[model samples]
Structures are given as structure tokens and as C-alpha cells.
Target: MVPTMVLVADGTRDTRRKEALHDLAEAVADRREAPVQAAFGSPTELRAAVESIEGPLVVVPAFLAGSDAASTELLAGLDLDSRFDACATAPLGAVPSIVAQLVTRLHAEGWRPGDGVVLAADGGPELPGNSERRQVIDVARMLSRRVQTPVQVGYLHAWAPSVSDAVARLRRNGHDRVAVATWQLVDGADLHRLREIGATAVTAPFGPSPVVIDTLLAQHRAATARLAA
Candidate 1:
């Protein structure tokens, strides 16, 4: 059997918030036939969760790329040579799996062939070419070719051509209706930024699409399989 592992998150105490994490954990566990332990709450809780699972383990962050202090500490603890043979996967940025999910969400939301899709991320000089921004660009470029829509890149924080700028340009170019597919997992900072830019239609993290769940599970399974090998 695959060695025991745990999924750790800083965790929101809100029941609604835990629902998504629990669902993804269960899906990954089912696919790999490995027991999964969830550790949520304070740093102590997270540490305990990591300790519970024996042997080599992986830390899969639910967050997008950012300078999260708590997350940084957790990663530092796991990155040490001893303790665990830990590898940190990029926090669900614009990996192929996520891009596929986003594209599907666009289609489900009635985005027509000519609709403009702007891939927006938390871009700023502070986080220039950060993992999240890079992944969004990659996803948008690939999606542009696949969807035949004008996919543009914009940033909410530190990057140029902000969503407002993109929107103005798109409107000026006669693309009146634009859909902002937030390249973010959950609605918080990124969502707020989207609102600030006056995004009328914003796609949900993964849009409640079944494929998003499956893609996340596949990522978990593939990561575990690589570790086992």
C-alpha cells in the first residue's frame, strides 16, 4: 500500500470552507487507495497532522503563489532533509489540469466562440512573473489557441495592463462583452480585485464543474505515484 500521507492547510474554521478541502481529500484518497488524514487549524494542528503520517510525504498547498507567512513556515518545516522526504507541489496555479478546468468552465458559462476571455492573476512588481502569473499566462496562451478567442493577460496587483485596462482595450476593439476568468482558486483577495475592476461576469474558482474535482484528484494521484516510484 502507498505510505500514509496527510493534506495540511492553515484551514478556515468555517464549515463551508472545510467542505471543499474535505471533498478534494476524499477524492484523492479514493483514487490512490491510500488513507488520507486532514489537519486543519493553527500551526500546532498543522504540525500534528504532518507528524501523524509516517515516512515520506508530500505537501500540496491549496493556495496560489503568494508570500503567505504561515505557509512559508509550514513549507520550511517540511523542506528539511530529515523528518520527511517531502516535495512541495506548486500551489494549484495554472497547471494543465487547472487550465483544462478553466476552459471547461468558460464553455459551461455560455462563453461563445467570439467571447473574450481575460486571464487575470495577482500580478505586481512585488510578485512579477510569479508562479501564479506565469501559469496564468501559459494557460491563457494555450487556451487562446484552443478556444479561438482573444485571451489576454492582466494583473490585479503589481502587473501592467490591469483588468480595467484590458477591459477598456477590449471594448475599444469592439469586444463589448468580456468574461473575466479569475485565475484564482477561491474568492477572497483575487475576487475582490476582480470586483474592483468592474467585472460583470466572473467565473468561479473552478465553476463547480465536476472536471475540476477530477483534475485535482488526478494531480494528487500522479504526485503520490511519482513519490512511490
Candidate 2:
């Protein structure tokens, strides 16, 4: 019997976000025709899910940023002494497929070639200095290359130059149209705040789209391949 893959996300207080993650996991499972489960909340909750499953298990963090402290803690909590073989995979954002999805969202939001775009994310203060900001910047650069326009990065909190500031800077630079692309996996208050940033257009978060589902399946395949190898 092959191992089941479990997708884990940072549990959110918002019910909508939780429901979204659950729906995404179900979509992945149906598409792959395999056992896939979603576990939300703390590391302990994820660990319990992993333990309940029989056979081998692959735990994939459904985070936009590559493995964070929560993922690290989840892996630590897994019982190494258990008979089932368990491994964790990288976060969903590491996959390049998301770049195409970002471009698609921007285009759908009426972004033109010369339009300035701001990649908005929630930068939590709990993380180390500038880590989340830097990651968003890297993704912004990728978006810039794809769209052939300058893409600036902005944070909702714990960082300089909010999304509004980024849009303002672009407007000041003489870009008539400025748009915002959210670098979030699910909807939350931050996304709502992005819309109020006064940008000409604001794209939706990277939800349970085909690209995301494909990326997770690819990650699962790669992890299973490594185990087989």
C-alpha cells in the first residue's frame, strides 16, 4: 500500500480560511484519486492526523513560504518510533507553477504591459528580521519578469511601505495604472485590507485553483519518487 499524503496549513481564526483549506484538500484528493487529508491548527493537530493514518505518510506544508517554524515543529512532533514511515515535503510556493497563476490573476485584473504591480503579503512580526519581506520581494521580481513591468513588494504589517505606499510610489513614478497581486494562499483580513489600498485593481489570493492543485500533486509525486529511489 502506498503512503497517503497529508496537507497541513497554519490554522486560522477565520472560518472561511479553514473551509477553503478543507475544500482544497478534498479537491487534491479527488484529482489525484488517492488518500489526501488536510490538517489545520497547531503542530499537535497535524501530528495526530499523521499518526492516525496507516502505512507510509508524506506531510506537505500548504504554506506559501517554504517551511516555517510551524512546519518544523510539526515534523518534530511526529513519532519517529512509530512503525509507519513518514516524511515531510516542501511548501507549495516553492513550485514555479504559481508564477503562471500570478500572471493569470494579474491579467484578469486588467493589468497592462506598463502597469505597475505590487505584490502584497502579510508579514508577521513574529518572524525574524526581513525574512518574509525578502521572500515577497523575490516573488515580486519573478512577477516583474513575467509581466515585463516593475513589481514592488509591500507588507500588510511589520514592514515598511504598506501596499498603499507601493501603489503611491508607482503612481508617483508616472505609471497611470497600478495593481495589487496578493501572495496569499487563502482569503483573510489582510486580503480585504489590500482592496482598500487604493490600487487601480486588486487580484484575488491564490486559492484552490488548478495550478495549486497540480503543484501539490507534483510535490507529492516528487516526494514519493525520492522515497522509492
Candidate 3:
């Protein structure tokens, strides 16, 4: 049987962002026979999500990156490990399609080839595993290659080179048209900051973009295949 999917996302107070996450869950569910649900916030919520589902279960993290860490901790906390067959898939940022979406969104927002660019992400930690930082760097590299323009990493928080700083650096280097490409799943405060921070253009969050849906399905297929193997 196709495994049940629980999409784990950070809880948001924003009504639109919450709806967008749910809409993503509905879209994924529509394409598959297996049940798909979105779980927002807390290990307790995640545990409850998987405990009730029978047979195989796959929890897909809705984060752009670094969710693998959360998944590990949450899965370890669950006593249901032996009660049902379950596993956590990699975060969405690990996929190439997400980087592709950043480019697509940029172009849609009038970002051209010659414009200097900053890849904006919700900041990751500077300490510990630092997985999110690594993934964001990788994404910046891919986006730079795609656009034929150097892309700088400007974190929303918890790091050096804020979005404004990155934009200023581009300006210093003679790039007046600085575009900020957002690598976020849903609209939120970080995106708002990216827009107001002097970039020539800012892209919107991916919020259920086609490639995002593709990424989820691809991960699910790969996970189920590994289990079968």
C-alpha cells in the first residue's frame, strides 16, 4: 500500500501562510491514493499524526532545509517506532526543483540576467550541525549558475550579511539592479523584510508551486522504493 504522509511544517500565526500549507497538503493528497495530512507544531502533534495511521507512513518536512534534524529528534521521541512502519524523508531544500523555483520566481518578478542577486532564506543556526547553512549555500551556488550571475547568501537572521547588507555589497560592486530571490515555502515576515530591504526586486514564496509538489512526490517515491528494496 502507498504510505500515509504527514507533512510537518513550522506553525505560523499568519492565516494565509497556514492556509497555504494546508493547500499544499490538499494538493498532494489529490494526486495520491494514500492519505496525506499536514501537521503544524510540536513533537506531540507529530507523534499523534503517525500513531493513528496504519501500515507504512512517511513524514515529509515542509521546511526548505534543516528539517532532517527535527525529523530525527521527533522520530526518536515517538514510542510508535515499533507500532507502525514509519520513516522521515529529507527536507524539501535537498531537492533541485526548489532551487529551480527560486529562479522561476525571480524571472517572474522581472529579475533579469545582469542584475546582482541575493538568495534570501530564513536564517539557520551558526552552531551545531549547521545543515541549513550548508543547504542554503548550495542553493545560492545553483541559482548563480542558472542565472549566470553571482548570488550572495543573505540570511534573514542569525548570520552575517543581512539582506540589506548583501544588497549593499552588490551596489558597491556596481550592480544597481539587485534582485532578492526568496527560498521560502510560504509568505511570512522574512519575505516582508526581503522586500523592504532595498532590493530592486523580490520574489514571492513558493507556496505550493508545481515544482514543490513535484519535490514532495519525488521524495515519497524514493522513500517507498528504498523500503521495497
Best by TM-score: 3
lDDT of 3 by residue, 5-98 (tens): 8788755446666677788889888887567878865687876777777788777877677322333344345454574367777576646667
Task: Identify the runs in model 2 with alpha carbons over 4 angstroms from their true place.
Answer: 66-84, 125-134
For model 3, the run of ten residues with the poorest summed lDDT: 66-75
> After TM-score superposition, what is the CA distance of residue 112 in candidate 2 from its true location, in Å?
1.4
lDDT, candidate 1, 131-183, per-residue tens? 55566677778778778877887776556788788877777787767878776
Give me candidate 1's TM-score against the actual structure: 0.73
lDDT of 2 by residue, 1-229 (tens): 5668888876745778778778788888888645897888776787778778878777876767622334434544555455536677755553467987889988999988888988876655444332544566677778888898888877776566777888899999998799898887777666777888788889887878988888887788887777676
**Model 3 — TM-score against the truth?**
0.88
After superposition, the stretches of candidate 1 with alpha carbons farther than 4 Å from their true spots are 8-19, 30-32, 39-45, 63-80, 93-97, 124-130, 187-196, 207-210
Model 1, residue pairs in steric clash: 123-158, 123-159, 124-158, 124-159
The residue ranges of model 3 lying beyond 4 angstroms of the native Cα positions read 66-84, 126-130
Model 1: lDDT of residue 138: 70
User: If scored against the real structure, what TM-score would every candidate get?
Assistant: 0.73, 0.85, 0.88
